[model samples]
Target chain A: MRLLHAVWTDMRFQWKHGFYLVYVLVTIIYLIILSFLPNDILSVGLPLVVFSDPSVLGLFFVGGIIMLEKMQGVLSVLVVSPLRTIEYILSKVVSLAFVSVLAAFAITGFSSYGSVSWLLLFLSTVLTSGIFTLCGIMITAGCNTVNQYIIKTVPYMLLFVLPCFSLTGFPYSDLFTVIPSVAALRLMLGAYMGIPLYEAISLVIYLTGMNYLFMRWAIRVFENKIIYQN
Target chain B: MLQIIHLKNDLRQILRDPIMAILMVVPLLLIIAFKLMVLYLVPFIQALIEFDILPYLYYVFVFVVIMCASMLGIVTGFMMIDDRDGKISELMSVTPLGRNGYLINRLLFSSVLSVFYSILGYYVLNVVELPFVTILFVSLLSSNYSIIIGLLIFTFADDKVKGLAFAKAINSLTLFAFTDLLALKWLTVLSWFFPPYWITLVVQTPHTLLVYGLALLVNFGWLFLLIRHYRKK
Candidate 1:
């Protein structure tokens, strides 16, 4: 019940701050522009767009949300409340995941009607959003300002996103599977090209493990850097 | 004298901030990476390409230089937003430095860094066959767009979160500069409203004095409008 209230509160904050509006506008623009491309191109481009919009967008905007809350002294207040750390973190992750799922569906459904698997898309979007949002919280844990957050996260962002670019062309390597985004990308691509049972099982396992690890890290960092420090 | 003092203080602040130090160093590192990519990766990729690689390299060079400037502008915008949140801008407004002096300090800092990065990026990319004066002139003109972006960020964003969002949105829009490589006529016409698009055009067609003039006018006009809006608010 408290988690639901927290999600509602965060959603209201996000809505009031225009994050939702910007997000919807960006999604609409991406869909409109992508609708112009050929189907084969859209097949490749759709996954990349999903990787960027929902996954990376969640990472960045959630980081900003946390930073904003920190600046507004809300985190300090929440730390003293009855709300557990897991509950607080879950609220953010779940709310962002909800938005990410809607966006991923909208983009995929609009662009590729009959070709893609809706179930795989839903799983990939939710898991990837969870991973990136947790990563964002972890990255911004010690940051007092946005500039500092950005500066610190650039290398990490590159570390995460750059590897995903390898999906574009030749020189395919299994090494990329170690990156969480690679797992997410595999799931997204699987939606289009039919997932093998082994690939599906393994990616699901890998992404789940990564999301758990990232969530644990986020909670630990939030406790030490944000809650205790404050 | 006042400008010198403000500049000195701003430089010291940048030096002291670890994030600003990272921002400074990241560009230098990227310049090195760009040089390596041109020397090593470009040749490899060029082998796969059917067309001339020189034009592609030129576009990438312009894109990198302008991107450097844009990143520097974002850094400056973050600094200004930080100051606003910390009430330092308020404090400065009460002093002889005033708000205008504060803004000028930010503008000077961002423009100087933008020009430096632009030149360094050009040198690293090593694709510009133009004369030294032309390269320098283009870099200066390109750097003004960074100033415009910095001021636009300051005017539109009220805090660090809003600043980040605004910076991302602005940078994404400015990336329309890359569309210039497509050479699509209608798209190029639409790209004119974006300042960095003019920079790409100026680099591609250096002989066109009218393009150069328009670049300067658009950037300066936006900078002025943003500043006026900020002051009014």
Candidate 2:
């Protein structure tokens, strides 16, 4: 369908814009840094590293992409095109989520050497990137420039990223898991340090629910602020 | 008069955006956060993990200030790209200000901001106490880094999106500031060519006139090279 085509086009656009090159360089740097860590630290560090960098890169990247499109007047054309708003949002999320998952896998695969659960890592990265990318789309919709988009993301990043400290054996971490970032980090940590089946299932379901809510919100924002220019 | 008008316009552009206003202060916030982390979190981590990070605090602080400078550099870079996209720079080239005047105005603005941020970051962090002269000179050397970064982004990226990517790549090179920490003999030699390494070297050994001279030389070398390349573009 058109959604798949949009995603493919978005991916090509991202590649042409050098997002993939940045990811490759960043992944290689993460690999180098992780390789230098001691084994004991590496185990604890791998998930934290992956959780912070690759999973949330979309939050930083989507703003630049949207702002650039707006500055170039591409959004005006898209407004009249047959491309649905949901497809536009999903294209960005899916394309960026693709990079995030690849980066997570490459980082975890080489650093952990197949000792971690692939399925959990995949699910964690997919949902985490999806949620953050949607959050990005929602934030960028109201902003005019990349600088505004970046600075506006600060409080939201603090909201999402700071709670993730609970993953480091903080007390009452289970209570924090309801927050999507915490849940995503828990899943990322779980990928390395095996969680109970029920915990994994619950975290996955919670994150999926959060992604749906975020996507709905993002579509509304894009339709109003970006599509309609209201 | 022209520079004043340009400055007024730039100030208006930044001040009008509430988010841009916040961006200006994020570095100060980062410094406060670093201060708090050292005061509270470091000890907590040391107690919990028994891994003390106090010894490496100097290098960490150096990296933070350099990072602050780079953030300004990237912001100025985006502004320049915005000007290009809007045809403002093109329009300015035909004015009495000239293209070179516009470029210097931007470079000077970021340099001045970087200098201010560097000095303020040092005072706020309050680690590695040094003489006022040392801090002033180090901040001066670090300012060129912002100029270099700004010109590099302007010369390299034709649009803001690519500028973001280029900014990440260029900022990663700031990692060279820690070449001494890595303690790799080969990297140490390689990092000598990087301006950040020399700025850090001056910080670690502030008394050496030779180090200060070399830092100035390396930083200005890069600044000169970037300006030439930018002019060519």
Candidate 3:
């Protein structure tokens, strides 16, 4: 309860900074511009090529914030505060995740053309990406220096973010629900194609479960040892 | 007792800082990432449909504006942290070196870096629509905005490491946003209000010398303010 309160306050602090709000507003304006393109290209191709996947944008943006704290030793300072590792990670997950989801929803909702089930797709995106973001936290947690973290993460981002566009076009098998972003992509494509919702729901369950377990392991890592140890 | 030599040495110490690497990577990141994207995407689309060169030109304008303006805002934020963390200003204040000397070196380095990044960005667009000599001036103005923003941020850096990290974050955000490419065809209304935003407009139309002129005025205006602030410090 206390940690949740602290997380809420932390979000308030971030909101007061006004940067996130402005960035989202900017993204909204960006999507509105996309709304004007010709239907043929706009519907099929424009979103993929021009907008690409907005999901990646959220992860990269939040990852940059996490990476900054690591770089500036802000995490180190915060670690000594009256909070547990779970508390800290949860704060980021709760605060940054909501804004990121909001950004993704706004972009996809405004631009994408598909069934009314797009809302479900957006929710699946938010949940599915939880694992990836957790993976980001776990992967980035133990780095020695800020530059080292960036070097490590950029390639991973290129690996994930680049291929994501192709996935929307390609048809990976049902087993793809196991791969994190793939599950999210499946949900989006399903919604766009108006495929059945059962698979989407099932994939969402797997994503949510994986995200749950990942957080458990991540907590252990935090409790057992110092992260960002050089 | 940290002298000019120490300042030079400090510069050498964290050259490979993540923030610095991000700063260095950013121009390349925006240009190359978007260009490769276009390269792959254009072929994919064209296979299914016909095309006009306007799409390609639109991309050029998009990237140029997005990269230029973002470079302006983010570099400002990063330099702020750099100057603050390194105890650089205080150390410099104690030395016989003029504030102008320290600031001038920053300008030189940042300008060179900005230009290098801009050239890479320009080349990426060249495969589509390389702006004329006039657009080159616009690129230069965008680069100058970066250098000036660095100076502005330098005066505001809370500390050196913070500066370094802020540099990386700001640079990353700006690159991801890529202001110029946001939306095209009717984009002039929104972007042209900002000076760096005109880089693409000038590149596309070449008639908006006034936009480039205003960008210069804004940059010089900031430069003057930065110098005045440094003197007070």
Candidate 4:
């Protein structure tokens, strides 16, 4: 299908630009650095670190990809093509989600040492990547350049990413669960330990719902700002 | 007079740039946030860690300031790369500004912003009680590291994506100042090679003229080498 071809092209383009290499290098380095920490701190910190890396990393990488395509006028061509807008958008989300899942696995596999559930890890990463990549696409929709994209997204980035730092410590608050990242972090932490079936199911439901809403919003924004504007 | 005109134009361009404006504002807001954290969250953090973290607050303040300086450097580097990509630098080469003139203008712009952020960081954090002259001296010396970062970023990064990767890598390397607090003997020994480490050292031991001089020499040496490499490229 055209969607698969587009996704493959995007993946190849990103790989050619060294995005994959930089990502792997960052993962390896982060794991190595975490290994240096004392065991007590490392155990408590691993979930938060994993949450920050693949989950939040999509925000920057996907934003960069969209901005690059916008700058090169590739999106304008896509807008005029017979390819459906949803397919084009899905290609981006799927490609970035693939990369994010790989990064999450690399980090968890190397750092957690079989302590966390692989099933939970995969679920959290897919949901987190899908949510954040759509967020990136939405944020970059109205911007034509990287600088503009950064300016518009800084406040959102701070809001989305900074609150998860609080989850690293104890005195767990019900208030933190309202943030999607905190929800993802809770799932990750639960995977490290164990989670009640209901809790795991609820969090997955919440993330899936949020992902659907964000995907809808991103598609709308892309149609209005990117497609129609061109 | 020509330099003044160039400076004015450069400042206007920065102001017009949304990304530069965001970068300028974010650091100030972070400084304010740090102040609030020290005022409110310190007690909570102390309770959590079950130790007095107050003594190490000065280093934390310096780390934040150095981070701001490095960010400015990366932004400046991106601006230069943008110029190159758009052929603006090539066009300016034939203008009255010339290439060297343009380079100095960009360096001055970034360095001055670095100094401003450093001073703002020091005054806002207010953790260390140093003489005003010492603060200014250290800030001026620290700003050179930002210039060095800018040049290195420009030399290595061909586009925005590569520029971002280099910026992250360089920042990770330069943030060794924080490692000095880990109290690891080998890390301290290794920290001596990094200019930000020297800046933190100067902050910790301001009375030591030797440490201050070494920071100056290292920062200048790196700046010289980076600029030379960039020019050759």
Candidate 5:
């Protein structure tokens, strides 16, 4: 119940701060660009757009949320509350993942309405957003200001974003599947192009495991940096 | 004397955080990365796909310029938000550094850094053969654009969270330069409203006095409007 309330409050907070509006504007822009593309090009471009923008939206938004809470001293209050650190982290991941899912669906639907594998797309967006949100939480944990968080976020984003080059047939690209973002992109691509069911299932399982590990890491970092002040 | 102290404090603040130091070097790194991509990757892709991308290569330089300027603007904008949150802005408004002084210190800081970075980015990119005066004029105008960005974020966002979102929106305005590349005549006109668009305009036509005048007018016009709104807030 408390976790639900936290998620609700976060949604409200994000809405009040115009995150949803930003997403809407960004989605419109994506749709407009996608509309202009020929089908042959969009067959490849749609997944890339979904993977880059909506799927990683959490990575961009979570820093602002965490920095705001930190600056406002909300974390200090929540620390003393009965809210477990894990629950706080879960609220953020879930609320942000909710937004990312909506955006991914909207963009995918608009670009290739009937052809997409909805199931694979949903799982990919959710898991990818969760992974990036955790990464955002981990990076923002030690930072005091938004500027610090923004700067620190670059290398981490590069860590994830760079691996996607493997999708472009960069040499030795198969090795990139070890990274969760690469897995997520592969799954997203699976939604566009039919992958073997077993491969799809395995990627889903792999991403879920990655999410759990990232969540654990996020919790540890939050507890240490924000809660314990270490 | 007091301004020097402010400058020192700003320097110390940036130095205290290793991330800021990295940010200082990021533009140079970006320039090198862009140069590398243009030099190696573009040709490699051309060879592989048999497509020519040479005609659109100028967009890379524009991206570097806007990116360098925007990063500085974001840094200074967040600094202002931090000051607002810490109540430092309020205190400074009453001190020897009045509100304008407080605002000037930050905007000037970002603008100056932007000038340095823009000039450096131009030399580092070094593909298009621009005259020295043109580079200086464009860099000066970019500093003005950076000031407008800083002031916009500081004025519109009451808190850091909002500031971050607002900063993202402001940075997206750089896309107008890409929009200018589009052949749609109406759309290109719309791009003129954006300050960074003028940077692209001036660059594309380096000898155009009208573009230089309009770029200055538009950038400073936005700066003036934003300053008024900021002071009102």
Candidate 6:
């Protein structure tokens, strides 16, 4: 519950940020455009955006958040807090994951066919966002400067984003079952969905476990590494 | 001659810079990955070759090509901006390495490196069935266009952060439209104005030498203009 408070606090801080709002607005305009697209166009647009969009926004904000905190000397304070490294990271995870899922859900509510399972759609987006946000934390936490972060993140970001475009390009909707982000999107489409409850639960657990491992790694790196010289 | 001196100096600095070391590795990584990914494409290509979905493949290739080029642009663009505010450019201004040499070296160095980076993307996939002439043409097109574009941004990017922002914005705007079919046809309509729009057409050809030559001329012409302005500035 305290972690929930911390998450809300961080989210409030993000919402009040002028640039954050501007970015959200830019994203909103893009979403609005997608809403108006024809079905054929939407088929590709939905999957591509779903696949790539998280990291686009996620990595930027994660880098900004970490960099800003370091610049302001808040990172040092966090290091000394009663919050364990896991807890400190949880604050970031809870906050960013909640916000990202909410945004995806809001967009889904308005733009997508929504004939799919709303609960499943929400669950899957959160699942992908959880892992992706953790990745953002890892990269942003490691790099001292924005330039290094951009360089390190850009190639992986491209790798992560481009292949999922193949999902829509290819016919086997089951492909999503193998790919994390695409699986989440499959749950989003709310159709052609096949998977036993046991299978779904196991997949979700595997993904969530990966996020936990990455978060711990990021926090450990944060705790031990002196991130900057100046 | 002063420019060659700064070129040497900048080259030394770039060699020492972590970012430069990184730029050297990126092409290699993409080449490896693209090669693996290309294995999958063989089957897809066989199916799609008969369809107008060539446009879609064209879109994907163009996206990948621009991604390669823009990565180069972002690197060269930021480093140039950083050098400008640092004592380096100001020092060159006073040295026998006159501003002309500095600008010329920037042009030559930037274009050459950008081309190298773009080829790495194809190397990973070993997507080299096209003629060597065609590959060179495409590399020049991708790299030179980015180099020219970077030169234009270098003129206005007053700081490192702004330079990075320009890099991201250019990459995003280009990649975004191709991936998102929502604005799909709208973007195709718009891509007519951009250089990457032609890359797909150039690469898909079995005897695309003439097409590549045309692209090289168009890109080199732009490069020439940007280089000229870079001098006057």
Kept native contacts, as fractions per model, are 0.43, 0.59, 0.04, 0.22, 0.59, 0.11
lDDT of 2 by residue, A26-52 (tens): 787677667778888888889888888
Please give, for residues A32-95, the per-residue lDDT of candidate 1 as tens digits: 5686677777878887788777756667777778887888899889978988999999999988
Q: Rank the candidates by DockQ, best first.
A: 5, 2, 1, 4, 3, 6
Worst 10 residues of 1 chain B by lDDT: B174-183
**lDDT string, candidate 5, B113-200, tens digits:** 7788788877776767677888898899878877888887888887887887787677668767877545567767877888888888
RMSD of each: 2.8, 2.0, 5.3, 3.1, 2.1, 7.0
Kindly provide the TM-score of model 6 when superposed on the true structure, using C-alpha atoms: 0.63
How well is each residue in B145-196 modelled by candidate 2, as lDDT tens digits?
8888888889989787788889877866886788676667887898899988
> Could you tell me which 10 consecutive residues in candidate 5 chain B have the lowest summed lDDT?
B178-187
Cα lDDT of model 5 by residue, A21-42, tens digit: 8778778767766777778789
In candidate 6, how many Å is residue A30 off?
7.9
TM-score of the first chain of model 1: 0.93
User: What order do you get sorting by TM-score, best first?
Assistant: 2, 5, 1, 4, 3, 6
Each candidate's lDDT (Cα)? Answer: 0.79, 0.85, 0.56, 0.78, 0.84, 0.61
Worst window of 10 by summed lDDT in candidate 1 chain A: A165-174
Q: Which pairs of residues clash in candidate 5, taking residues 3 or more apart in a chain or in different chains?
A: none
Pitting candidate 5 against candidate 6, the one with the higher lDDT is 5
Estimated TM-score for each candidate: 0.90, 0.94, 0.74, 0.88, 0.94, 0.63
User: Poorest 10 consecutive residues of model 3 chain A by lDDT?
Assistant: A46-55
**CAPRI-style docking class of model 3 based on DockQ:** incorrect
Predict model 2's lDDT versus the native. 0.85
The regions of model 2 sitting more than 4 angstroms off are A112-114, A169-171, B48-52
> Tens-digit lDDT track for model 4 on A66-111?
7667777888888788888888888888887788778878887888
